[model samples]
Target chain A: MGELRLMKGNEVLAEAAIRCGCDGYFGYPITPQSEVMETLMARQPWEETGMVVLQAESEVAAINMIYGAAATGKKVMTSSSSPGISLMSEGISYIAGSELPCLIINVQRGGPGLGTIQPSQADYFQAVKGGGHGDYKLIVLAPSSVQEMNDFVDLAFELAFKYRNPAMILTDGAIGQMMEKVELADFKPRWTNDELIEKCGSWATTGKPAGRKPNIITSLEMDSAKMEANNKRFQEKYRKMEEEEPRYEALMCDDAEYVIVAFGTSSRVCQKAIELARAKGVKVGLLRPITLYPFPKKAIAELSCRIKGFLSVEMSAGQMIEDIKLSVFEGGCIVPVKFFGRLGGIIPSPGEVVKALEENFLKG
Target chain B: MDIKDIIKPENLVYKKSELLIDTIMHYCPGCSHGVVHKILSEVIDEMGIQEKTIGIAPVGCAVFAYNYIDIDWQEAAHGRAPAVATGVVRLNPDNIVFAYQGDGDLASIGTAEIIHACNRGENIVVIFINNGIYGMTGGQMAPTTLVGQVTSTTPAGRNVDLNGYPMKITELIAQLPGTSYVTRQSVQTAAAVRKCKRSIKKAFQNVIDKKGTSFVEVVSTCNAGWKMTPVGANKWMEENMFPFYPLGDMKDSDKKEVSNN
Candidate 1:
């Protein structure tokens, strides 16, 4: 820990990026997440850490910029909201296809198109399933609190480079705007050229040295046979990630009969809902998925054997319930999975979630 | 002198650049891409920056540009080369960065990227090839297509009402305050090739000087796309394309005053 400071989630992310030796940040402003860039501009990381902070023309440009910087084996990141992230979908595919390691922070707002500035977890499907084209997946870290927002910034970068894939901090407006006291991590220095060459010399284009062929970073494989082989390699990497990286937390699930699967803000609400449900003798527990892609399927399936039913609490009408269904059914033990949610910036209260759980899952 | 003796270093008048690979270019015989590629490699080799230069290849005909240019390269999505170059140069400011794009990639789909990159005055070079048609996709009308030009898309010569006027993108770029140098050149004739090479060198040199957004637009010809013989296409480009996209330096902030008009 470096210093304890009260900070907003978006601001904490910016601070963590600078302290984590982020080499560059390229982004365009959108609602509910503009502070990420605003804070970086205010901090003037260029002077402090020699990090390059640029306000890109648009989200499309920003993501492609990440692709370029990451090609050089540098730590670069970008921040956007729902609409901006959608615009960056094409570039994100390119980044994923090229297998560049970088961080993207999506402080999600309500969507379908310019829906609202308030918080929503509607982007769960897009983040976990790969928002862009092709068979790919971003290592998504869902941060529910301001502290987690601060912590996940470093973790996301770590996982990104560990697997040589793009990582996303899938947060929402509530976490981005709220403030909390956080113990900041110690600062790390940016990697020197020699260090980059040592670590990423196999793939990164850090300028060709004598006696070696030039490194070309591109996703284009015109030959269909070769392209299929490349995709198989990516699939193998994704499978390894799934085995090693599925993360989640089970609260009060040791002897519970009914369970609630949630994440981000909804998980916080579920925390309160569990207290309410337990007092009413419902014996409900909460399973908060931290990594949405390498989804805690094994944990959820194991719980399904013990629990009577599961209620998926979410900010959207129902996005993550599909994954819950997949997990519960994987073991041939089909427990009734219900969804209680709101949409378009609507935040369900603890009382509402508890009532819905009782009416939907606990009644029978 | 014997044949072997005549091939001595002192007697040799010209040799291809080592920076260019021996692989055959996919371009047609008289297409300007090969000529342009050769000149670019020549400049990089002569400037002794081959090892330090990083090139961004666009998604047009020259997407395989990395195959020929023996330097660190990145192949960008169509029209995203400038945005990609922006990232490359910002992170690796010590290296020479440039993007090779055709009209369709730069002027049509990627117009905003190029404009904003130029406006921001990013310290990178842009090599734009205006062949009045999309060559790789086969004979489609490009944004730089001449008025009253015939193409697969504009079968009945381009009409302003239906297709709008051809974009004079180089002239528009020269007006941006961020651009330090802007020139429109061609490589149809031997003399023209020499001038075009000079323009390319100046563009690269401007980046070394830390001057922002040096743009070199080459009024090239797509012989196959234009439905003409290689020799005829060169002559036609001289007559038709030059009048619209004239050859010469449009702006040079290092030498003359620039207006952000």
Candidate 2:
């Protein structure tokens, strides 16, 4: 509650980055998310806070830049859409392998291959599952509103540095382009050189002092035994994250028989859909997942015991519903799990969601 | 005098650079990489910048460069060393940054990264090793492989129609306005090795002075990949490689000042 302003999601993201003391931003322009770099350029954060803003030659270069800076234990970030993120996957895998902390924002558009520039949630599997070559996890956060977009920048950095892993704001074109009132955070000073050394001196690639050994940041381990040991350490950290990080918002779940599961913009639609379903004397609830990787599995599993069925509403072709079914199965519940989605950048409406739930679950 | 008296401190004439660790290098016998690495370590030790230098190791035979050079390092993905060095230098401008890359890593898959990094005029050093063939991943045709060179991928000698011609990437790099110094040198002889060392020192000095990109290409040999003996490889390189990839400075911003003065 530092200051209030009406801004686009992309602009708020850039402003929040400066306010949160981000060290650098390296990005390439892609439609539906170009405003992110555009806004950073217009703000001239370099003049104000010494934040390094660079328009890289391509997404591949941008992500590698993030890798280099993050190895020095700096709060660096990049933003892009689906195709651009795909280009960054190789670097992302390297970043993950090196166990460096950084932030990535994907304002996703529809895509099998540059499918559309409009809103879509088609990257859920790619984000939650491993999109790159190796077995690694990116702490994924889904923000449904412009306010959350402004807030998640700081939160993502905090969690990333806490775990020494990459974190991503898995948003979409709808929230990226839409305008809303956001309460911005207060300005925090960027870390001084002394502070950076104090925080990251143990593992970061800051220059070696006279008394210490050189720090080498690499992912290549020639020996299979050592490589397996490194993989085990990564998996252990992910398990701790799964135990401590799953977040969700449960709406009217006290006495509902059926629940609508969604995230990001689709979750907003389900909120309205819940009201429509209730007015028709149908008992419905909403379970909105905020962290997609440390998914709200426990909550969904608990809900499976009481709810008659779950309708996973998404803007893709039945991707998240598989997770819902898995949650129910893990919870030892035999409840029905169904999916309703719109593909190719089409956002499902409240009325359409209500109709889909009735036709898929209640009718059967 | 006794042999023990000759080995005393006062009689010492040469010793290994302290900047190089005791770890044995994995480079093949008579490989040019070993010579270049030794020279680089000596330069860093001479300048006393070991505590302030950060090196980017590219994906090739030099991937384990961090093991040999006692300095902070980041191992970049294939062809991404320039981009990674850009990240390090922009954020930590006080540190001397450099990228060590191979022919395949720089001239082919990473063409875009090297070109854009130089064009942006990033204040960093680029050490390019052009052996004209891929040595780490078996003997394959490299972007800098000579037109008539025979490799695993080009067994019948490179066909102009299929493999195109050897890339003169250093010449392209010299054309970029962001570059302040660009040179091509070799390591076939003791005199040539000294010359290459001078060029590398100059490149590092340029970066320290905040001059734009400094590039030094060392035309090298790969005996195992070339299917020749160590001595034979050096003779073959002098006979064929030198004529195509001639040694000498291609561009020097400092020369402009000397000429003007």
Candidate 3:
């Protein structure tokens, strides 16, 4: 087994980035996620793995840095919280438009405008529905535990480069701050310059050699027909991801009449709520969505055929519930899809979730 | 002699830089951007660094700079070219990186990005074109717009109370310790054009020597934005612009005696 150690979710993200052979990390410190850069700084990964870590002036600068580095065909990333992520939205859009591969981590905090420092999943709409302005989608991965935090780094980079699209780890303040045992992956050597040319030379902005045309990474297309074609190409990519990338976990769903749809910290709470409801003779199960963008719509559609209803529990004012409802509707099922959420960073307990499920889906 | 014989190789005294593509530029006639693009491409060719050079194209007229220069390039969002260059050069130290930006992009919307990238001593070259007005957006007033100069946004001429004074950002950049070389030059005359070319070449060499951020501010003219003929704009710039934004080497780490102007 790999080396196991107790670490905070944010810290494990840093360790995982280094162990996974990330070439560079550019970030601006924000609360609840500052440890991501702090841990990297303290470890001095440049000394060990030749990784370059820099504290950018702002989220705008950090995200643009990711754009530049990613254009050069390097594994680059950045991390921030809600407000910072908002600042990065424009740069993120540019990155998406340019079709560069990179990772962005948003350890979410409450916000309509700097709402609170505590955990909230309100950025769901922003993360999965093209956070930046464009006809594009980020491959959003929701991690519930510190272990998933450690695992998703490599996985996100893998998927990002595979599709030449941006990927994000949509975690929260709770998981970012909480300490848990994580098994760190082995040190993977960074791709050499020769390997980079072999893999990304087709499009990446590596310096042009003689006999080859210069590689220009840009999103601007003055021709309307060309721009529309690019947009269609992007939509095709998202559709491919939807078909091949949706990941979900269904617990006790085989025999359940009522299912609770949740993700991240909320999903963990639903697992406990499942046990509580089962003990009380209520047949409830949990359907946890791990990839929020390429959401488990098919799984929910299949479950909608037999399930009585779906109760989406979240830490925001009913965001994921919309997706669940859409799934049920797409499945052509006439089942009730309900939402239960605590807004402004309040996480619901198992008993509270069970009560919400019963009040929304049960009771004559 | 036949026309073909006159056009033979021996008769040709000069040719366009091979690094420049054959595509026609969209820049307006007499716009300094074309001249700057020509000189930059010539520098890359002369230095034989075309294969090891990367460029960051900023928003504005120069956004299509990658189309003209035959080198690897990443087009940056408005005013964020410096930060993008930081990322490119830091990861690939062996590659020479440079950012091309206009006044509105560098001095206004992207102020934070430019200042911080310079302060961090990123090993890259910055080609800052200051024409004192936003040319691509129909001559809007820029942060570098001179006081009492009339722009589309300032039809009654810029006022000190409402619009603030013109910013000398090159002077500010020179003060940053992280910067190894800072110079302000123009391309209005043949002699000035030669001097500007030398300055650009020097900036690129600094990157090779591992010197920190090298900034070259080209005091340029936007004839259409200025609402004047090409010849009139040149005369106007020499008379008014030269006083405030003087042409000289402001700072150089290699020389102990640094000139303020």
Candidate 4:
């Protein structure tokens, strides 16, 4: 245990990563996420922990650096915001297609272009869906507070290695800059790179000489048959991931008729709405998804079987609602999956969410 | 294990076949990349680092260097090999790491990476091939293209009026404190090829010694772009390229001769 100290969310993540024994960090300075690199550079872990930190030329170069380091079976990471992340999409697909394990953090801002630098959960689809080309999914962890930001960095790396795929810590600008008291573990490296390579070297890109042919580390296999085999290997791994990685938390859902579902920063607001609605004799409950990709379908469906209707709330313009509809009705039930929210950086207050619930879930 | 055994003509040393790739070479017949690749393979064989060396190729005519070299490789976007190599080598310092780049890829596009890697004193070998022309893009002017020399982009004979003069990359990098070895050698003549091999080998050896940033800037020929025969191009590089780019070791702190004059 360490002394309780207040820190920004992104700072907490950078500190946790160093403590976790991340060997490489390549990132370009971008707002909201700039602190991640600044703290890492000032810390100069290169001399002490053999941690290498580089300010990459661009987001594209940064992610590719992660790809290269990851090929050596190192726990490497990179962080960026909206436009910067959009640039990393192509590399993300390549890393995923290569089946490399790494962590990427996106402190999401409003988007489509140079969207506002304010907080927004509009990237929900981008985080869960393959934000890049090809078939892939990032194990997206949404952090609502500084504590979760600290906690999720370790969790993201754990899940990344466990599934042999990329994991994303998807938060918003508020979570990145806002301060909160955090209790972090004293320094201890979880595992060395040799340990990671020993477990993953069969597919790694470490060079082999005359007696052994050189290893080819590429996502491009012009041969359709070979490409299909690679896809199959990833598919089986993803199936195993789906079986084990779904996570969510429900509040006051035991005796409710209407369920309000949300996640990340929006989930906090939705929980407040659920409490306020119940205080007024309105039966309401909240379902918060900790893992956005493995969208808690089974649990939501079981609850759907009991509730009258499901009200979807979020900070995005109806992005997570689509997944909510699929999860709520996957069990063959016909409950209406209603939606409500704002777009870009605008967030609906709990009062506004309660009103939407009354109009959509309660009155109906 | 011997150099001759590794570089046998019939063995397809660096690859399963030949450096004469079937990928429709984007380079002219006399472009020095073919020669550079042949010698690089020979060096890899001699040092016994083919198994340990990871070659990161930059975007240029040599984009397919990975295909020709018989070792592990990952293709990097323009000017990014130094950064990418940094990632790989930092993770596995025991493994040999190198970057292959042309003037355009290393000097213009990746200048930041090349300079920073050297400044940070990263232990890696960088082979910088300076042919004075963007050979891949059909004889376009390059950062290393000499003043008063003509190319596609500088058709008016690289006048000092509009077009800037050549960039002395090796000379500039030698100024950085992180560099332990930097040489401006050439492969123009048979005699020079022997010297070039020694220069490239020393660069790689410095990396093995944990010495920071070893750079070899080879003043190469681009006969296809120069519109000259192979023999004439070699002579032209001797007369024209050598004067502006110069030849020999620029800086090597461990050995004698402080500068490559």
Candidate 5:
């Protein structure tokens, strides 16, 4: 087994990427997540692991670099915060529409603009829902701890290639900057680009020969009928993924009367709220989404029958709450729903969530 | 046979390798992209890195560079090849990485990426095409376009006061401590073509030897964008452009030391 070490989420992410033999990394320097680049640069990964690391001019260029490398079926990735992710939308859409498999990390910060340097999960809609244009979805994994940083690197690669889709780790500044002991896997899998070329060769631009079948890597579908067919294929694949990959962690939901809905750092906050609310003789429990896209609807919908209401507490301006509401009982049931959130990296204290839990569920 | 006559197929003189993308050329009849692509592809073939090489295309005429390169090709936003190339080279240092850009893409928009990459001493090859005009966006005043040169946007002529003087990217980058070699050559006539090829080879070699950022600026002509006959454009560059953007080694670390000794 590999040695255990205390590492920040960003550092763990950098190490995990190299350990997994990522083909390339493209990123610009920004606070909170700057440690990702600093860590890679400090390690001289190129010299050590023959890993590629580049400090791009802007987040826009960095994502496009990922776009360039990902086109070759090479395991590639990029990381940015909210504002930078906003700049990366166009390229993200292109990569998705191109049907390329790659990983993207967003150490989320506050904002609809350059919101704040502090941690925020306000990009929930952008991460889970489609932020960029086109009918495409990225498999979003939310890691609450540094240990998950190592596990998610392998998982993101697995899901990316498995679904021919882009995967994102929607972490935040708190997780990115926080240091924690992480368990590393012992097994090392050496990935070769040629193997990917052989597997993903049907469409990859790996230098097709003359007089052979011409291959095109484009999202541009000029023909209406062809586009319709492509969309149908995408929808079918998404449905299959949703069935196979619903991941989440639930606590005491079996006997609880009220469910607290959250993900990422906000979920961690709600966990504390759950503990306090229980001590105060309240029957509130927490539901944390690990995979935000294939949302944990099964457990949530089941709990809707037993619970009085669902408190959707988030770090964003009520983004994931919509998913929670839509997932459990849809619009039919008056299974009451309420939201509490703080935008632009200002997190609601567990006291706030506990207070809301008391006022909304316990009192009623 | 000097390893040149191993192939049995009579129609193909070289190895039966797919090192070039099979596609139609969108460049004008006399644009230098085709020639430069030929030379680059030849080098890629000779080096036997078809599977382990990646190329970044600029936003100019070569935006669809993925269409021409056989191995792996990525298109960068205009002037961002170095940034993209940095990402690729950093992730897989074993792979041969290069970025191709035109004047507008390199000297104008991508200036930050190239300069910072050089300053940081990134081991990537940057092939800058100085065609004296923005070929992809139609002819406009360029960083390399000389004073008094009339481009479409310039109308009557490029005014020094209004447009400022031409920019020398190679000379500027060569001064940086991070850059080991910065060369300026043209791909015009046969002799110039030889020099241009040499610079590219040298830049690739620098990357192989783990030298810092290797920059090669190739002065070329955009006949269509300049609204001149291909031959006239070549002549214009020779007479008017070459004086401002003088050809030859701007700075080479080893060459400088050798000459000093």
Candidate 6:
């Protein structure tokens, strides 16, 4: 256990980055996540941890900066809201194509356009299903609490470097702005250039040493055959991730009649809904996915065999539910997966989730 | 000595820069990119920073610059070289970083990146190549294309109202206080090539001195894109491109002190 402090999700993210040995942070301000940069600037991590914090001109430049720094085998990241991440699509695609390791935190607000600054999980599809162009997938981690926000920063960087792919924390505004007690991690020193050269010299764009040819960082494969081969290679990595990285929390799932599948802040609401449903003598459980990209497909598929049905509770009309339905039904098992949710930054309540269960699964 | 003995190792007077890879250049004949690439390689070799230098290749004719220059390279998305260079220099301050960008990749779509990176006074070099038309993309009009210049996009010679005026981006960079040195040079003649090489060496030295952004714009020619022979293109560039984008240093922070004194 490290120091415990009451902090907002955004603020803890900044502190955790410093403690996790982050080399640099380049981000532009957007609602619900601006405090990420604000907190870094106030903490002056440059004076303490030697972290480079810069307020970029726009989300596009910020993400590109991550691409550049990540190429040098540095632990760097950026945070943004929905519309801001949308502007970063081009840079994100380039980063993915180059196979550079970096972290991106999307404390998602309402979207479609510059929708709202309130909490929403509408970006589930964008995060999991390649928000940027090209055949690539980000290792998506969804944190339900401020503690997870701190913990996931380190985990995100670890997974990013482990696979040499971009990783994202697909959180929402509620978790970003809400204050809670967090036990921070112990400080880890940023890797020196010598250490980085030792580790990632084979691929990283560190300067070319005497014996080696120059290391080129680029995503453009002009040859069609080569591009297809690269795509196939990425697909294999994603499959391996699915095998090794799917993470979820199954609460009261044993011998349950129906399961409530949710993630992020929606999972917190579903926890309450599980309590509410149980009070009414309903055997309901909660299945909260922690890794959204390497989704708990196998878990959901197994649950489909035992549970009567599933109710996906989310802050969006229907985004993650599609993945749930596909995962459960892939084996031709008709487990009766249904969706119940709000939209445009509206937080679905526990009562609403319980009502959805009673009306859809419990009755008749 | 006999003629065969005269061809001995000691008698060798000139050789291509060791930094240039033996790969056959893909640039079109008479294109100024090969000339600029040769000069840059020679400069890097002369500075003995081949092991420490990192170059950002642009998206136009010189997109394959990495194939020619035997140095660590990052292929930036069209127009994002400066931002990419910023990422490199900020993290590795000791490394010599520079972006080799064409006019379309710098002045148009990537205008924000170049301006912001300059304004931030990033300790890096920007090698801007302003050919009046896009070469790799089938001769399209570029941001630096002169008025009355005909291109694939401008079927009937460029009109100011329709196409806008040619941008003097180096001049714009010179105005920014963050820039320590700004110059526009050409590689058309032997004398011009020597001057351009000197300018590039100064830019690299500026990086070592931590003297902020140093921009060297090489006003160049695209003979294939211009529908002309190599000699014709050079003549046209000398006559038209030189007047709009004049040669010589526009801003030098070091020179300011001597002149002031």
- Decreasing TM-score order of the candidates: 3, 2, 6, 1, 4, 5
Of candidate 4 chain A, the 10-residue stretch with the lowest lDDT total is A208-217
lDDT against the true structure, each candidate: 0.92, 0.94, 0.95, 0.83, 0.80, 0.92
lDDT of predicted model 3: 0.95
Winner on TM-score between 4 and 6 is 6
- Candidate 1 vs candidate 4: the lDDT winner is 1
lDDT of 1 at B73: 93
Model 2 chain A poorest 10 in a row by lDDT:
A355-364
TM-scores, chain A, per candidate: 0.99, 0.99, 0.99, 0.96, 0.96, 0.99
Candidate 3 wrongly placed segments (more than 4 Å): B1-7
Candidate 2 lDDT by residue in tens digits, B166-202: 9999999998999999999999899999999999999
Compose the digit string of candidate 2's lDDT tens values, residues A1-364: 4799999999999999999999999999998999999999999999999999999999999999999999999999999999999999999999999999999999999988989999999999989996899899999999999999999999999999999999999999999999999999999999998899999999899988888989999999999999999999999999999999999999999899999999999999999999999999899999999999888889999999998999999999988899889899999987999889999999999999999989987784
Candidate 3 lDDT over residue span B48-154, tens digit each: 99999999999998899999999999999999999999999889999999999999999999999889989988999999999999999999999999999999999
Q: Estimate each model's TM-score.
A: 0.98, 0.99, 0.99, 0.83, 0.82, 0.98
Model 1, B1-261: lDDT tens digits are 689989889988788998998999988889899999999999999998877899999999999999998999999988999999999999999889999999999999999999999999999999999999999998999988888999999999999999999999988898899999998899998999999999999999999989999999999999999999999999999899888888888899877655332
Ranking by lDDT: 3, 2, 1, 6, 4, 5
Per-residue accuracy of model 6 over B1-261 as CA lDDT, tens digit each: 689998989989888999999988998888899988998999999988988899999898889999998999999988889888888888888899999999999999899999999999999999999988888999999989999999999999999999899998888888888999999899989999989999999999999899999999999999999999999999999999998888888889898541210
Off by over 4 Å in 6: B1-5, B257-261
Tens-digit lDDT string for candidate 5 (A137-205)? 889999988999889998998899999899999999999998999987554544666686577777665
Q: Whose lDDT is higher: candidate 1's or candidate 5's?
A: 1
Question: Residue B215 in candidate 5 has what lDDT?
Answer: 87
Angstrom error of the Cα, residue A165, model 6: value is 0.4
**lDDT, model 4, position A240:** 74
Alpha carbon lDDT at A137, candidate 5: 89
Candidate maximizing DockQ = 3
lDDT of prediction 6:
0.92
Distance (Å) between predicted and true CA of B36, model 3? 0.4
